[model samples]
Every structure is written in structure tokens, then in C-alpha cells.
Target: MELDRHGLLSLYKTMTTIRHFEERGIPETGQRGMSASVHSSAGQEAVPTGMCANLSDDDYIGSTHRGHGHCIAKGVDPKLMMAELFGRATGPNKGKGGSMHISDMSKGMLGTNGVVGASIPLAVGAALTAKVKKNGKVAVAFFGDGASSQGVLHESMNLASIWKLPVIFLCENNGYAMSTPSEYGVSTTHVSDRAQGYDMPGINVDGMDVFAVYDASAQAVARARAGEGPTLIEAQTYRYYGHTVFDNPLTYRSQEEEDHWRARDPLKQFRDVVIPQGDITAEELDRLDAEAEALMEEAVKFADESPLPAPVELYDDVYVDYPVDMMKRGVNMSV
Candidate 1:
């Protein structure tokens, strides 16, 4: 489906933001060795940007370790995320949680999980809450191919289908599970094929193409909202980095394989294919790229300037030694 000018630009900007956020730790930011927490979503920007576009602030999303892109797409402030990675008190979780645990309940971002397939059950729980409350809200689990192997994900899918919960199991099959490629681990040819085991619809989309992902996710979201239970979407995308910042991808995958995926970069695809087809011009798109860079630079600066959490506030979000003392900490506590 074709998108309007505003929609196209909005998707572009979101993808650009994710790309930059992930790239900040690369040589482009001149701090390649500075942070180990940053997980590169370098090429997988379209999945979250497109899928989250179909969700509202009330609609929840549970993410994974490589979740900066997901949080940014869901309306969390990039500056705060950067600060969290920098271990600053101004972070979403007061810098304590950092990259793996960025949670902003006000924005309906349940939390970014470090554990594989953990988001599935968490999002299912949120959907159950929504169903019980009759809130008419949907919950989404943005997981990966690696997490697809986890038993909890299968259990969550079965439970959601049995109860007709309003949840979408959005999987980002980014070709590899860390250094181990997906082909060696996953039994099914496509992750979505397992959706049938739970008696729900399964869709496989070109995760590299933003518009395709957007359209597919929109339909699945509409189905969930209409009380049609859940749908599993396996977005076939690729990540242009190792499992984490410390990983060297060249050790496992060949440079040619990496080069092949990099050539079909989502941002490049949007700029080249969508821009000429949509109302916006290449110049306008470039302008947006420059703007995104400026915003990320500001975000980095904000993160760097943020203060570190104090030792005294260690129990800020935890069960404290005393209730009255915790009360003294106030209701608007950090995190």
C-alpha cells in the first residue's frame, strides 16, 4: 500500500532516528570503544518503525536487548535513552537499568528485556490486563528469531490464542542469533509458520521494506483490536552488526554476506524507492537526515551532561528498608 506524504516522511524520520541512535556508538560518533551497552539495529530499523506506527501510546510494546530503535519508535525521548546508556541519573530508569531495561510506562513501553523471548510473556500479560479491564488496548511483543526458539514465546502464543487476547507477536528475523545464524537454530523455514500451531494467522513480510511492514502490522493490529485474537508476523530483516558492541561479526559470517544485506539497507530503500514514488523529494529526505543527525548529537550531549545516580538513592524503585523513609523519597521518584 502506498502512503501519503506525511506518513512517508514520518516513517522516514523514525527510521532515521533509529539508524542514528544505533550508529552513534559506531565510528560516526567518534566513540566506538566508549560504550558496550549499545546494540546496533543498524539495518533493522524498518521492523519497529513500521510496526509501532500501528500502535498508540496506550498500546503496549515489549522489546529486546537490541531495543533502542523500538523505544524511539514508540515515542520515548532519544535524549533520555542516550542518558540511560551513559549511566546518568536523568535516564528512564535513573541510569540503573540502562540499555536492557528502559521502561516508560507513561508511554506504554512496558520495558526492554535483556532475556531472550522474555518480552512475549510480558506483552501477553499486558494484553490480558487490557482484556480483563475491557480497555480495548493491544499489546505487542517485538522479539527476534533467536527468541523464537524460547519456549515461553510458544506458550505465550498458545495462551493468547486460547483466550483471544489482543496481542501481536512481531518477530524480527534478523538472519542471525548473535554469531549463530538463524538457519542453524530455527527448525521452521519461516518463524511465522509456527503461528498455525496456535490456530492464528501467520504473516511473513519483507522487514527491509518499511511500507510492507507497516501495512502488514497495521492489518494484524486491526485484527487484534477487533477481538480476533493474535497474529504472528515474522519480519525478515538483517542487522548490520555483531550481537553486541563487543562482538566481531567477521569471525562467523563472511564479509560478502554482510555486504549483501547492507546493500539493501532499509533507509536506503526508503530514500531510493519510496521518495521518488511519494510526494516528497530526495532533497527533503536529505534535509530530514541532517535534522535527525542534529537531534542525535543533541541527545548525545544531553546524555553526556546528565548526572550519575547517587549511592543513597539505590532503593529508589526497589522495596525499601522502611516505608516512611521511602515515603520521604516522594511519589515522583526517579525511574
Candidate 2:
């Protein structure tokens, strides 16, 4: 698929944003000894960027633990996201929610959770609400191959297909679900094949190729919007990092495997394809890299200086209404 100038630039910007943020943000948050670890999507950038290109700000997205890519693709602010990762008072969830639980409801980012496959049902429920209200909004669930084994995901798919809900199930098949290979954990060779049981359209796409993923996800998004039904998309991509900061990848996969995937990096592929096609120049891409780096630096500074949440905030944002005296104690009732 030949992307227009705007589309190419948007793809480049989003992929770069995810890369830079993961490269820097993870270490910054980890170094503070916050006991926080990020499952960085270092190499698997194209799938989320391409898939999210088919969505609007009003469309809902539920993300996985390694979700910085999805968040950036869905138009999340790097500053606020960095703040949330840093657990600062100025974060999107007032620092209450960390990396695995960041959410921006106004932007249609329902939330990310640590529990594997939890977001699938959440996305289905959101899609059910949209369908019932006839809102014309689609809900997306971004999960990893590891999540495919979770029972909730299958239940959600059954419910979604039965109701013909406006939801897209995207499985980022990054070879391994933690330390276990997809071949070992999953029964099917292609995750999309499992969609047959639910009677929905199933598609398997080359996730490393942005255009391919874009075309596939665009079709699924269009189908959902037209009230056709849900679509299950399995994007075969690879991540360049260990499951978390603590895991030694050498225990499961070799340096050669990591290096092999890194050699076919998504950003490099996009540059090779788009730059030669007259859509953008190398210098323009470099400028974008510089701008993204600067933006990240500013975000880090903001997070470093921000205050921790107040003691009283522990009981806040949990419910629509709080205790009467707690609200009267200047608890910022304007939520």
C-alpha cells in the first residue's frame, strides 16, 4: 500500500516516538529504584502504528503490559505518559496508575493492565456499549501472543462475534510470550486461525511491514465501522528486549536471534521504503528524530520535578462519589 505524504510522516513520527520513549523512558523510570519494569516494544513498532492509523481519537483502545507503542500510536502525550511512568502527581492518573495501568479516557485509551488478557473483555464491553448506543465508534484490543491462552480473551471473542460488536482483536505475535515460544504456548500456527471458532474474519499480516499491517487493520476497522462484525488480526512481529528488566534473555533466546530481528528493524524498513519514494528526505526524518528526542527530554525533566501524590489521594478516583466529609475536606470535588 502506497501511503500518502501525511500517512508516511505520521507513521514515521509514531514509530520514532515509541522507539525513543522506550529507549530512554524505561531506564529513567527504572534507575529511580521505583521497582517498576517496562516490557519495551523496541523492535515491534510497526504493528501498533499501522493499526492505530485506522482509528480516530474517539475510538477506544485497550492495551497490553508492553503498551508504549499502542499509547503513542493512539495519540497519547509523551509528557503525561512519561509522568505516569514516573508515578508523579501530574500523571494522567495522578500518579496512581503506573506504566501498566496508564489510561486517558478522553483520548479513548481505556487503560492498560498488568493482568494478561484482562483488556480483551474490557474492549468487548466498550464495543457492546458503542453498538447499543449506535455511536459508530470501534473498540480495539492490543494483546500479545501470551494473552491468546487466557480464557477471558476467548470468551470476549465469542461474545463479540455473537453480538457482531464493533471491536478489533489485535495479537502482536512477537515470537515469544515472555520466555515461552508461541509454538509452545499456542496450539495454532497462526493466531488468526483461531478466529474461525467465533465465525469472524481472521487475518494474518506481516507486522514488520508497516504498509501491510496498515492495509490489513484498515480493512478490519472499516468492517467494524460498517457494522459488519469483529475482525481478529494477528500481526507477526518481534520485540528486541527481554520480557522485563529482570529477565536475562540469553537464558531463552540467543544474541543471534535478537540481532537477527534487530537487523530487520521496523523504523529502518520504513526509512528504506519511504525515503526513496520521495515522500520524505533523510534530513527531514533526522529533524523528526531530534524533535522527538527533545520532547522526551522535556518530559523527563517535568517528571523529575513533579511531586508525589498526596496521602489522601489513595481513596480518590476509585468511585464516582467519595465520602461526604472527605469531599468536604477540600478533596477537589470537580472531577
Q: Give all TM-scores, in the order shown.
A: 0.93, 0.95
Worst 10 residues of 2 by lDDT: 326-335
Deviation (Å) of 330 in candidate 2 = 22
Name the lDDT of candidate 1: 0.88
> How much is 212 displaced in model 2, in angstroms?
1.0
Pairs that clash in candidate 2: none
Name the regions of candidate 1 deviating beyond 4 angstroms.
Answer: 25-35, 320-335
Winning model by TM-score: 2
Q: What is the C-alpha RMSD of each candidate to the true structure, in Å?
A: 4.0, 3.4
Worst 10 residues of 1 by lDDT: 25-34
Give all candidates' CA lDDT scores.
0.88, 0.90
